[model samples]
Target: MPSKRKLVAASAISLAIVAGVAAIYQTFGGESVTSSVAAAAPPAAEVDVAAVISQSITDYQTYSGRIEAINYVQIRPLVSGTIVAVHFRDGATVNKGDLLFTIDPRPYQAEVDRAAAQLASAEARNGYASTDWARAQRLLTDNAIAKRDYDEAQNADREALSAVKAARAALETARINLGYTSVTAPVSGRVSRAELTVGNVVSIGANAPVMTTLVSMSPIYASFDVDEQTYLRFLSHDTKTTVPVRIGLANETGFSRQGVIDSVDNRLDTSSGTIRVRARFDNADGVLVPGLYARVRVGGGAPHQAVLVSDAAIQTDQEKKFVLLVDKENKVQYREVKLGEQHEGLRAISDGLQPGDRIVVNGMQRVRPNDAVKPNLVQMSGDAATTKGSS
Candidate 1:
């Protein structure tokens, strides 16, 4: 009976061992379940991609510039006098020969009258001299008087003629002085506020005070400088074909106004290695003003087939610029690219890229060189149209 009890205890102990082993296996099975879940997950990273564009691109070179008045004039009095009247309101638009100010004309007028009186007296004397000379000639022909007397009368007549000429010159001088008393605009432009008021004394010549200033209203100039290389290229271009330029104001976006290259400086500035260039634009609306900042762009070259990519897709690594391009197998590779002018929203890839290369446009932060990616191809045409419109 004691041996049977011992055998039953041993069987119970064995059953307990089997149960503990099964429980430990169930706990480790959770790890196998996690391994299967990880294996089922996607390996490639998802990224937004766009194809490189191929199109005819017209290149442009941008520059910083300023607006200048085609015609600028400083209005000053031509004669020294008291300002008696102001003909134009302050800051009024003036046309050529428009009266702006009137200096006191009474003094000049009095001088003119004095000259006229002298001229009249001289003319009367000349008439008398002519009669006397004629009488002297007749007397000499008939031998009715001494030769010295005739000679004296001829000499007197010649002296009177000389007096008339001097008087006439004096009269002309007085008339010119009188005309100078009235100040008129020499150009058609918008005038600044008068610097001198009525009752102020104004003077003539270079040391004279400027009464006002004028700047032309229509067809203004936009001046900028181009580098020596660009200047040479411009000179090498066909002379007859005008180069087109565009400009934008400081507050504006893109180059909204158009112009043509009007002139180039005769010599390049050796110190700066640049040449001055001026472009003219229509300003009939009077919106363009002198001394305003302008963003200018000159035509670079003829339109040609070029590869384009979004500026957002470009990546700068150290000193070099690059882009992330995906191959046929959707493996991302780093490509070094040479960039040209940016137009619309797209940048011209002058070198290092070809048409139809897929590039990462968005999600670039999630990508790296040699990364395997699940690329979502997006239509670049729509983006191009939007960019072109803005540009």
Candidate 2:
């Protein structure tokens, strides 16, 4: 027979064992086990989804460029003299033939007077010589004067006439120098500050210092380099028709100005594999400044059908770009894609996508390939939710 206390302790141990087995069975048995697993499994991830947008879009190529002035003039003095007066405010808009600076006119005026006096004296001498020559002709005809005297009178008359012509030429030169005393704007433009102020002496020569700069305010230029493919595709074929272009400043988000292709380089640069291109834009408001950074968009050829998507949906897979495609089963499938230039606010898909395909646009980082997702339909470009289901 067992002891009483030992029997009681054995009974309690048996009850505990029974309870443990029942608990284990409830957790791991048939339907119970299935229910436990079902409770533990996570729900499908929610993500923003939209169908790919397909439209006829112009194929545009973008390039970094610089704003330039169509006509940039460095104002230099044509005559050597002291600058007597500055006629324009710094950075002021000036018209053609507007006086920019005034040099001292006293010296040129004196030269003009001297040349005029010389011309007058030569004319008087020429008058007297003409009279003498007439008299000599009469004398020769009458045989009253020697032939040698008549010949001398004829030579003197010719000399006086030559002197008068020389004086007239000198007078013309003096008048031209006097006109140069007023330095005027050669073209309508915005003028820079005067490099040489009043009382500053300037000289005329090949190495002469520039007095100021003037740049045309309207019809500005934007210059850029284009690759060989772009030049061949859009520029080389057009012989007469103007190609259209657009430009955006550094601070702008979109291309706001419309322009036309102005010119193209004659030859390609073998070293750079590009050709220089220039476009002209109207700057009637004078907002475009030279040397500013510009984003040039060159569009040509014909409109073509393209599929577009938001940039947020793109993913980088090592050396390749990819996106998450949500099929009809709501399963995310990995898709590699080739990209093209951006149009409007969306990126154009050159390959690996088609119209009506649903793509994960947001929350891409939360899901993986083949994972089940709960897609929330939205616009490709906007944040507003839509009632449309995934395609």
Candidate 3:
């Protein structure tokens, strides 16, 4: 009944229907369908990782302060007169008892000569009186002179001896004044500029004529202040003996010199709530000078061992500090931490960390907690390099 063309057309329709049916059947079939296409996911982002999690750290606090000298002295003239000559140049170093200045000695010398002449005259008078007394005594003993006359002669001789003793005392006083004319340095130190130069009149009382200023330099002092809390913290521990210290110029890094704690102020300042502490260092190199600002660090207590991380490695929230940790499966996790003082670029972790733990240092913003990521090798250069440690 059907023609050849119709038969061919029907066969084509049937084949199409049959294939569509097979596709539908496969979509809901009991047997599962398999395809080569994988899940459409975002590409893995590169990240930097750090494996060093915990370390030993000695906790420390910082303070700002100034420097001073251990032994500072102001030199003054003992007597008043024009400074005829100065033995030491301004700001020169001198030993103890070194001649510093000279005052005119002619005045004192004249007084000494006057006293000596008085002594000689007194001695001559005493010699004559002694002869008279001897003669009087002889006459009295022979019953040719009165006892009153002999007594008078003895009195005269005694007066002359008293005058001689007085004159000798005056002469000694003059000699002492003459010796004081030559001034001297009292201590061995580096002296400051001579406040009084040659021809500058100095005084005993008009004012304390400061001839020079001296400061002991071999063992100089470094003065720094600690806040009330910090001062108390160090004192609470047994620091009866010397505490350790190190110093450097304020702007310079790395404390280059080591010293010892020389003293601790007994009282805390009420106004500032800080206590002054001092350390003595041997400035043999003359590197440290007076009035210099320095970075001073004090060390104490038992050695502390703890987990440490770079400051950049740690993240801070409103009230807490945390870090991103990467697990073995390349998954990241957010870990909270308790932090102590930060020194240099590292922080002392007080809690919530351990050694050998891996952390995400670079690409932190790109990853979240429990994020699946691909950790690429961290190159030493670029913006992503924010202080990383080998994992």
User: Which pairs, if any, clash in model 2?
Assistant: none
Deviation from native of the Cα of residue 369 in model 3, angstroms: 4.1
Model 3, range 280-306, lDDT digits (tens) per residue?
888876666689888887766666787
Predicted candidate 2 versus true structure: per-residue lDDT over 1-391, tens digit per residue: 4699899999999999999998898777878777888999999999989899999999998999999998999999888999999999999999999999998999999999999999999999999999999999999988999999999999999999999999999999999999999999999999999899998999999878799999998999999999999898999976513677999998887899999888898999999999999999999999998999999999888899999998888889899999999999999999999999888778899999989999998888999999999999887873333456534
Write the number of the candidate with greater lDDT, choosing between 2 and 3: 2
In model 2, the runs with Cα more than 4 Å from the true position are 1-45, 130-158, 238-241, 369-374, 382-391
Q: lDDT per prediction? A: 0.87, 0.92, 0.76
Worst 10 residues of 3 by lDDT: 379-388
Candidate with the greatest TM-score versus the true structure: 2
Ranking by lDDT: 2, 1, 3
Query: What are the per-residue Cα lDDT tens digits for candidate 1 across 159-224?
Result: 999999999999999999999998898888899998999999987777999999998888899999
Off by over 4 Å in 3: 1-48, 53-57, 87-90, 109-180, 227-233, 236-239, 343-345, 361-391
TM-score for model 1? 0.76
Report the C-alpha displacement of residue 276, candidate 3, in angstroms: 3.5
The lDDT leader among the candidates is: 2
Error of 3 at 382 (Å): 19
